[model samples]
Target: MAAVTRGSFSVLRQLLSQQYRRRCFRLQNFRSDRTLQPLIFRCDRNLQMFGSRALHTAIVSQGPIVQFKLSDIGEGIMEVTVKEWYVKEGDKVSQFDSICEVQSDKASVTITSRYDGVIKKLYYDVDATALVGKPLVDIETESSSEVIQEEDVVETPAMAREEHTHQEIKGHKTQATPAVRRLAMENNIKLSEVVGTGKDGRILKEDILNYLARQTGAILPPTPFQEIQTPGPAPAPAAAAAATARPVSTPATKPPPTTPKPVFIGKDITEPLKGFSKAMVKTMTAALKIPHFGYCDEVDLSRLVAVRAELRSVAEARGVKLSYMPFFIKAASLGLLQFPILNASVDEGCQNITYKASHNIGLAMDTSQGLLVPNVKNVQLLSVMEIAQELNRLQALGAAGQLGTGELSGGTFTLSNIGSIGGTYTKPVILPPEVAIGALGKIQILPRFDANDQVVRAHIMNVSWSADHRIIDGATMCRFSNLWKEYLENPASMMLDLK
Candidate 1:
């Protein structure tokens, strides 16, 4: 009798289950059943009422927020500091409008807006460091409803966490700050290849620096890590009370070494380095690592001086300011034709040398900002007059701090006219990759013995050269210098090579 009763109850339960499933199936096809459409809508509306109205309707009519990230402004630039901003929050901006100015290790970069929008937020302040690929500002831009709906669908925290987990599982995302990623990119090191030691397996800047130090056998700052606590589920009140009673142990972290601040003896003003001055510091640090071969000599510039004076009138009529730099640069190009090795660059491994096809001679100028070496592109193809015109343009631009990255890079050789600022001889540092650099001193009127062995007044200029001793031997540098000097001494000879 008990078995019969149990079987009857099981049969009734199965029938009720079937009925519930049929009702669910009809509701799932509510669009086909017009009678249930209003009921389903009413249920949806009731559920939405429990949710925040602002969360759903707040951004429905408004435009989407766009993040303006910093891009690669120059080669090998890892980070830049915000210098100034032209727009602020709530300001309306048009496409291609000036947004802000930033200073990198290479040059000053002007950022412009890519979209027409209102500035919603600024991520960085003046003098704050901003990493490449990081957001510099937030802009509110107009968009279509379809795009807005798509954004809203994925706006939940659960959806975001799921997407992040998916990327992590697929190994498509790297856990790192933008600065760390940039450093890895600059060194050609893959972030996945290095072991991270930060929270939740994130890579820090110190990790990259330490990895590099290990590879190069360099002594770097010590790495200090704090104690990491694993998260767990909450316990009952009684268990939590017992856990709280127990003493917690924390690992000690070593403090980083600090340098002693300098004490001033008198009135001292502190100034921060930025832009060109900051770039020069980094450049000089790297340049000093290469072995330099030095060569010094004096050239009789009396003939060249007279030739320049004769050409001044012609240059002025053409609305060009002709200087000795054009003749000096043209002569160097001619010398490069005879000895191409002086115009070549060597790899860090010293296994290969690149002989450049173009003579992109760089001319160093001292402006109010700092020292700038803007080069004259394809000096080999340009005439002396053309070189002079380009030189004038670079100087003008440098003075106004408006020189572009292209104007400042790809120099095959460099020339510094220390004479303009008053110097007899200067040991110019070789701008790396480039094998040689030359410095010209002020021209002085001095007596010298000519071929007749009689003392005569002549315009003599002292020149000093520095070259990469690893690739350029002393003999090679001297030979190149002599050839360069011959053209400057006999200004008429450069005309033979001048096409």
Candidate 2:
């Protein structure tokens, strides 16, 4: 009887295994069409499916939150060490709230949250290196009907555990663009509950402006200016009304003039060098190491000025304004074509002078942060309008302190426009790895003798060239300067093959 029972159990298990195999075989057959497709396509689809699952799992487990990995911070910043945490775990953070501080070799920046949620977890400790694009924290969202906490509450580490709880929160939120995220971080603006009015519920620039306007009391009218409108004394409360009552017969008397006293103060004050200030220091230091030779020349800009005015009108018609820098750039390019040696740089270690084929002009822009010289890549090939556009973009980026690392590098020549700063003439320092720098001073109408020996008041501008003495000789520098002046003064000569 025992042998019969064991045999019956074994037969039942075998029949169940057969049915399971049949079902698996049918499933495999149904998926055979997908398997027969290109292996690359199949792999890509599989990856997409896996990514979707991972994203879903992360969102569900972590709550309605997205972690901007360090990779999203910027290009080439693969990893960064955490300097500090502005917002602690479990802290209720709005979108664009500075959550943490990070340090890279290039710069120190604050990392902000991308969504409105409670910070549930911090993956990195202080000074821990977190790679770009790696999850740094988890955030749990709050419900719509839940009363928002008014008081600022500090978050604790214990809240990390609650991140795993599978609870759904009501209310949908908009995601911010990378540009908007940067703007908010720089401006200290809170994006959550800001009411986005963009398409698909996106936050536009106007929304940020509106938020700022509201914060600054834009709805209120401006206070009227009055010569004697100073703040009055505070009103006494009802309890002290009898005691505060004073005689109204006498006219209001002015307080006795106080003697001025000098306050001597001593304290340790440290000014942090950042942005363009830091960049300027680095550039100047590098330039000091190079052996420099200075060259100066005055260019007759009468023709150039007229041409610029004509071009300005044309540009206005085309909806593109032109600046004097483009004319200088073109003239410098022409001069470089004639005298390539001026554009060459000597490598002391390599014991060779390298001449660059491409003419990349670096424009010196004075920003509020500091002096910045961002380069225009391949300026020789671009038209005058293109050069103007590029210059405008570089100036805009420099002013905003948003210039990329590579945009600051790889320059064949540098142009400093001191003319904008009310200088008639000035010498500019040569940026290293580049042989020469050209300075454009203020243009003015001056009396001068022409080639025909008649005195005339002509629009003139001074061009000062600073070159590396080791690479460029005085004669070659003078030739380059003269060629540049000739191109500018003639204006039409730039369009011809003067080389």
Candidate 3:
């Protein structure tokens, strides 16, 4: 009976195995017919180890290769018309080596290599637009070579090329700050060569200095022109002798009172305004549209002068030189704090007055490019030493004509120091967006009565304030001016509050 029962169980197991095989075969046939939904086999592992490994390998092999996309190239510099190629395919290059000469908007640029590599392929034909950031050529680096597949050709799309071309003509060229481009042009240096030392590697003055130093002996100086002498024809014999004997005397009738003819030339040649000149015109026009009011005041800086000298002595011991600017900046900051409205800007379009919490003071720097105001960001938060350092930096950059767009823009208030130019007093124009500007004049010794009614010589400075009348009333403006004057008269107050 036991043998019979075991035989029945074995038969039942074989029948079950046969049914399972038939089901799998039917599923396969359905999948092959493409008439049934495919089954997704769920993996036992929670994490996809194979996919993770593939991604890790991809990341590792791609290495440091920066495929210049259309964006990497500057705006308005989208498609560069390739003028010349400096290297052939497979040529090895170092960072900053001139790669090609490309023309855009009548100007030509020698684009440089941003990384060290071997040229694998040239993407465009000569005279073609190499859109900014679009790979002009493929670079075969060790790491890139590992990840480079047969299908990974540097493909630039037609739309991308067109976009690059449009950007080159419209945006990039217009957005470049005048100071930076002027420096590049004056030195006959390429903008790409000047590694921006400012925020985000935006080129600054110090970068220009370094570039100039490197290129010093590479460029030849202009040679002076030599004088040329031309021979005159021999004089007629008898007639010339008579003319010479006449003493060439004009009856001193003032030679008929010779009136110079009003010379009318042809059409005057005109160049399209560009760079700082264009920017200045735009800023001034915008500022003039705003309603403005001017207020002038005189401050006795005698006590401040004494305090500055003492502070300078202390600064010298600490290996940092102190300038009058820091004292003035601190004083101005204090005054702004006392009357926050002075640091406010009026949005006439929105009909709103906006008060700023942090004082980002703009310093009007006279650069070769023209008057540029690069702000010292968060001036209120920095110490006097820090302010002096930033002021020095801004001045140095201004002189080198290396200020960036970011530096050139954004300021809650502006300070124009005409004192350096020996000006006693002058009303400065308000920098737009910011409602007010202050001008510092030369400090001079003038006789004035003290609190005790004793007349004595005091070092005094003229303070000129200009504000947008639409934002501030005359009384409020006077109050702001008075606050500044009080701070300058007692600089000790600045030290205490700033500290």
Best by lDDT: 1
In candidate 3, position 8 carries an lDDT of 100
lDDT of 1 by residue, 1-499 (tens): 9999999999999999999999999877775778866776777666678566766777665677877666644366768878889899999986546688877766666665656678999999899989876778887877554544543444333343222211121111236666777788899875533545676445678888876764453423222222112122469999999988988543345584488899878987897886677888978998998898788999998888788778877766665667788888998998899889999998878789999999999988886567888798788877887777667667756756766565778899999998877888888998978889999988788889999999988888899999998888998888888988989998877777787
What's the lDDT for residue 95 in model 2? 61
Model 2: worst 10 consecutive residues (lDDT sum): 163-172
- Per-candidate TM-scores read 0.64, 0.56, 0.54
Task: Please name the candidate that would achieve the greatest TM-score relative to the true structure.
Answer: 1
- In the range 206-261, model 3's lDDT, one tens digit per residue, is 66676575344222111111111112236789878888788742223222235678
User: Cα RMSD (Å) between model 1 and the true structure?
Assistant: 24.8
Residue 475 alpha-carbon offset, candidate 3, angstroms: 1.0
Per-candidate local distance difference test: 0.74, 0.65, 0.65
Model 2 TM: 0.56
Candidate 3 — worst ten consecutive residues by lDDT sum? 221-230
Candidate 2, residues 5-29: lDDT per residue as tens digits?
A: 9999999999999999999999888
